[model samples]
Target: MSSEEEGCFVNILSRNISNIVDALLHGPENAFDEARKEGLLEREDLDRITNKESNGDKIRACLDIIEGKGNEKRICEKCGQEAAKRCVTCGILCCDQHLKRHQQEGHNLMDPGVKIEKLRCTVHGDLFKFYCMDDWSLICPKCKDGQHKEHEVVPMGTAPNKLKVVLAEKHCRVLKSIESNESQLHEVQEEEGQTQNAGRGAEDLLEKRRKELCQIVNETVDLMKGQINKRKMEKLSLLGKQKEKLEQQNESLHQEKSSLQTALQEELDTASFLQGSKDLLKRLETMSDFKSVERTPLPVLDFSKEEKNLDGLITLNKNFLEKIEKGPVEHPEKVELDQNNLRRLYGRSPSLDPNSAHRQIKISGDLRTATLTRTGNQYPEHPDRFDVHPQVVSCDCFSSGRHYWEVDVRSSRWWKIGICLNSMGRKGGKSGLGANPESWCLSKLNNEFSAYHNKQRTSLSVPGDHERFGFFLDCEAGELTCFGDSRVLHVFRGNFMDPVKPAIGVWDYYCDSVHFVHLVKQTFITN
Candidate 1:
């Protein structure tokens, strides 16, 4: 075909492109394949059309490709004559002689040289003059009278202004979220640096202790040094994981903000802009529900008290070297509660307080188990609720007498079982199990166990497989002791000035429920 003739054919295709796209979209699933087999579409064009998410968008893209390839000779579909006019309603090419007959039948007609913009509703075949706010769609007058009758409809011209306000607000929120993520990332990096410095300091202290004990007990010094190094590595590992998580969150926020900015800068029509903005805004809202990372001082190793005890032992026993020649000597025995003592100390099982639970914590129907969830719960705002950590406290508090409790932690690998002052902070970084001065906890993080109090950690030597843990608190003696299956793990000594409640925390989503064991006399058994 000649270039002039091809131009005329292209104009005819472009004039009724919307109708052609609509027919192809609703025709069949193999329409693109058929077009490709007929040599009207190329392989790359088919691939491009397939990339579109919606059927309408795919057909429109295909029509664009076909229109660009409009160099073949064409004839009027009605008669064996050169096509000169196009029907807008039926999307058929017809010569001027046959066009007059179609015009008499009330079909819209357009010249080959006239280019038509697709502004008509596909369903109603009327020009879209209204925008439906409820559905975020464009509608015609007939559509407004039918399905969109109760919708918030406005003139198409005014819809862009309303959408601009919404997009602006969403843009501001995304910016703020990006800023918040950046701030958290900074805090995590700082914590990481502090942790490294603290680790070096602890190593130095360990070196000094090694020298002091090298002369009297070389084997014990090596063991202590190994424990210190292991603890340091664990601390650094935990901080590294936290830093990585914060970095990923910040990266996601940046991408979301970039997409929003691109949409704002594009010269899209009102309908396209509204649809794109609606999707972006929904995603922005979801991504904006970010939780702040809890900032706590990294725990450091303090073997000063242990060093003093070892020094005292060395001074008191001159035959310690002879005893070391035999197998490993036994240290002072830890208090192991028998079945009778356990039964005597066992009090009523304490239930978790829903109001004190974090939004990601789900309290069970029995009120004794607290489980971590991937999504936040629709919890009502309460002053005692923990906002930063996935932690919760018991409903009852102990003040005057001795109290005993057991937690079934068989299902979780990372958990904290402890007691905190009833007046402890509940909304900040220090609200965690043992982050503040008002709490004491024995935590099992991965394979390591440690006792935490006032942000200081004392590494405990305990078996990792112990599933049930017992806590015995003597308020009068100002002592809180944690016991594994057979032996006491660690103890925290402090003046009990206020009532304390049992608390539990779960850090990871993979962790299961931390249950408060209900003590029954019939099945009472203790290790």
Candidate 2:
């Protein structure tokens, strides 16, 4: 088409499209008037175009232009006539005359929704024909057999579908892992909050206990001061009475002396002077005949008693403070009961085994106590008997459930008492309780208390004077606790492999004695 003719056709086509859009937006009557006013078409041209015959013609022209056809001077590629259609696929203008011929020539019609691009392979200079699964690389037929012959190959379109499924599964797994981690993180955060709250509660409780103890100490001091003051006031009142009587006697003596001097200085006749002298002499004799007042010493207010009481109070306060400083004590989570009740419920009497006793140990006739003897017995040679150190094991053995026992090591300056596995070494040099792996024991040497296990000595801050020791064992949980004077001394935890028996031992060098309190089956009558 000529440039000038094409421009004019394009203008008319655009104007025709604008008129149709305006008619759709605003009614046809308004659009016709707007077209005339805007001079897109003159009044005469607008009237002609709006006529039935020409109206449809401009609309048809607009549709042809939309399809890249119907230029005023455009000629068909096949026929030298005005174009009526455009071959979308071939990008050529066509007339109705050759449309059937063009379709018969095997040119496909264009679909606006479908897009086709020619993608080339950089290496083979061919289209991407196959997908290699092993290398995840695009391959042509030539490269497929050369470098990727061993790889699993698929058609380009199918490869993407297969990868989508795999990618979906991997994405799902990643999301699942994230969810699991998030759940764990949430649990950890919750536990952290609980722990912090528990710590705060414990701090508050301790602070309250501290204040209570301080108040108690202050009250005790105030009471002692009151008592001291009371005694001081009583002593002072008694001393004041004695002082008053002494002062009255002193004043009486002075008044008597003044009367005698005044009579001697007065001028009088011999008879008068003699009478006065006699009177004065009688008064002097009466006044000089004074008996000494018995000197009563002031009562002394001794604070020694109060001081002793304060010392006891201070000692109690110190012990309480020490307990606070050591943090909370671990008590068995059981029903609240008195020691006797607890013993009645869980306690079992375990006597010293005759076979397990060392020669230097003497088992009591009742089989309830074992004492360190000065002389070794003529015991039969036994594998379990202690050859070097004095020791004895109980006859009763426990494998499961909770068990309780008590031992009295009051007389022992050096002793060990605890539970040991029945299979613990009996004759080896390292067979001593707590010296081998088979035993856990508490020991007291002189004033020092300590725990012993596997040849390790763990010092325990416990009193050595605790005469009675209680042992609680939870075999199922593999826990053992030692209580000294009813206070938890130490708790030992381990997976016990064999049945354990209560064992007590004393050093041969120190002939100290230890007694076991045997529990008897009796009905505890509660009143």
Candidate 3:
């Protein structure tokens, strides 16, 4: 079709559509409602909302709005207008004006038909029964007299007071629920706004990435095409060189033939010339054999592979950028909780003696080749940093000044270990607890996070579970075995650099086979 004709048709169709929309919007009773609600509803919108299939939905929505369902009701009690069913007992009402006052006044009223009924006496008609001193129901006056009247009787005034207290409690609970739900709703709205902002950020990133991709594509096209052209030129130059070589060979052959003809003029030299010419021709033939050299192929970008890698990198970049914008890193403090230190902190172990300051834990070979073994807590004074380790652990730094150690549980004995770190060196500060800083997986699996510390075992590698919390020191690349002789419950790993420092270690309660073998030197982990 002609462009002009297409444009004319599009304009006519658009006008017709607008007219049809106007008619559809202003068609019926709800047409006015729609106009007031959201201006005019176009024909397409009307069709979607008022189709036969959606009639039930429309009716339900209308009922919800008209009948005040799924909406809060506020009315003025003084005006007596049926604003909403704010209270069933008092029939409280409100309008736009005095709604707040009515809400405050009628909010304390008891629910209709919800009050406890009086237990009437069969013998004495009007007087209500009284509650017994014991945890029993109310008794009539006659029954009280017959049952020997010593039981406590709630006074008439007491009933009202008790009911008021109960009702107040109920109202407070309702208010609290409303308040809590509103607070949660506000938080959700804020979170939603943040998510939308993140989406906008993602869109902006996508646009930037699109520009970069376009630039890359243009550059790639140029490079690839230029490479192909360069290959073509190289092939042409090689072919020209081969042609020159062939021409030189042909000329030399022609010269040899002419020399042979000159020699053939003498009969005696004829045979020799012919033989020599044949040899020369053979040599010429060998030189004329040109090996077909293939031209180098163009470099393939493997754009698909590159595109996948770029996609991953871009996604990571977007995530990283968003994280940087979000900004949640202020740096958290860590605690080093080992056996000797834990016991000392918990008042089990004693403090190091000032008089006999020679108490020491031995350090031998390099952490990688040597072993990190603990004797027991030698201190006899301070119990604040006490722990329940099977042996006392004191740290010894290796020659390289690297701290490495291991914790070996006694045997297949049932035990547990816990570990904590105190990076701030605060004596009594708040900290998370349990073996791991995650969840509480119960029974044979329940794990919880709790903050705790130990004082005696100042700095040592520790590793353990919640039930048996202990500090952990990085062992060799060997598997970390647990529980029993079977390797079934082992945590396997590869190798890592751990000689940097001696980390706190938490280990099993039993002294069975628990051993710490450091790969480097010992690290003195102090504040």
Candidate 4:
């Protein structure tokens, strides 16, 4: 062959080897070693390739194809838990839910111990619980004198001894039979070995081959036993849970039965007591007739000494009364209004959406940055504090500061301006923690500014505060003014902030249905 052609063949061989190696390295791990140990791969042909053949690559490839690619996963029909393949009768696939149904419907349910012999006593019909020995009979204890006394009495505890004696006799018979059978088996085995050795080389080779066959069979038997054990454990686990459930149900029924019995007893007692009471009432009525209606009264007399003691006691009580009167007169009661109660009395938005129950939050697109107009009760003597409490009233899906609405006011009066979000409390308590930030109204540039600059909004106190728990609300810019008894709040428009989508959490926690009110550019609509 040309050198170039030879080099090409070598290259092809090397590439094929490399590909095969890569597949083994990265491929599934269902190696045939496990199959061999478990005796599934015990055929002489398979053994020849794996142990005798010098070609390692060919053997590994054969093993991989056989063990790695099969879809033999035994999934439970109920829970889908994987199980080793086994006979369906073994019940490996059943989960707790399905196994309970099996116990009720399957012919072979969980273990019910040996079927006990039932021989009733001649006298009572109760359960027959004992066994007699001499006659090999079953009977209740009461039957001892009637029927079982003539029999040599042996307790059931000594049953093993009786069984042993019977088994010993059988063994003697079986030993004789086995001796005869062994002679026949020996002849058969020798003949069989000779027949097999016709093809094989020597006696030792044949014997070794025979032993290997036995070992393979034994390995298969062991694998079967392992499968059976695994199946039984799974079934027992399922049954344990079902049994626990049934036990709970049984206990409940027993308690109900006990309660019924007690109730019946109580009713019987009540009826008996009522009848006895009726008899006593009749006796009392009859006795009343015997008493005189208007006879000479028993003498009414009082001792003079006792009368003087009573007078002394009355005088002491009079002095005590005078001392009590001389002391200060205590106020009867003072009425006060619960501030939180007043806030509850001040209700929220007219209607609530049904989805509100699930805490579904939505962005408040309507009311954004509104001028801090002096609300009902927080207006101060001076009004410059409206700008002092610059606030975001509501927000939309976008949350860039650029898209925000701004509110400003220039009023000469000193005012206590505030910012607040309109939100409801969870479970009707305070929103924000225990304190409600839903109805938050900020303090003006009043003495409270120094008091609350460092503290949280919940800590900021209003004398007549309502439910105002405050959190961060991205707001749009707007403006408002305050004068006389009236105040005006306004929203000056701009594009919404870019890119800040609505938060699923804060939106659901905050506003209800928000109503947007756009006033003509410059109008005081306040009354």
Q: Among these predicted structures, which one has the highest lDDT?
A: 1
**Which residue pairs in candidate 1 collide?**
none
Ten residues in sequence with the least summed lDDT for candidate 1: 326-335
Prediction 3 global C-alpha lDDT: 0.31
Residues 328-388 of candidate 2 have per-residue lDDT tens digits of 2223466333456457546777888999888889888988788788878888988878777
- Candidates 1 and 2: which is better by lDDT? 1
Predicted structure with the largest TM-score when compared to the true one: 1
- lDDT (CA) for every model shown? 0.69, 0.59, 0.31, 0.30
Model 4, range 75-181, lDDT digits (tens) per residue? 33445544222112232334455566544542122111111112224466432434455444545567766678787654333433453454344334434443443
Tell me each candidate's TM-score.
Answer: 0.43, 0.36, 0.23, 0.17
List where candidate 1 sits over 4 angstroms from the true fold: 1-118, 141-153, 208-216, 288-310, 313-527
Cα lDDT tens digits for candidate 3, 164-185 = 3433443344344435434444
TM-score of 3: 0.23
Overall local distance difference test of candidate 2: 0.59
C-alpha lDDT of residue 80 in model 2 = 57
Residue 178 C-alpha lDDT in model 1:
65
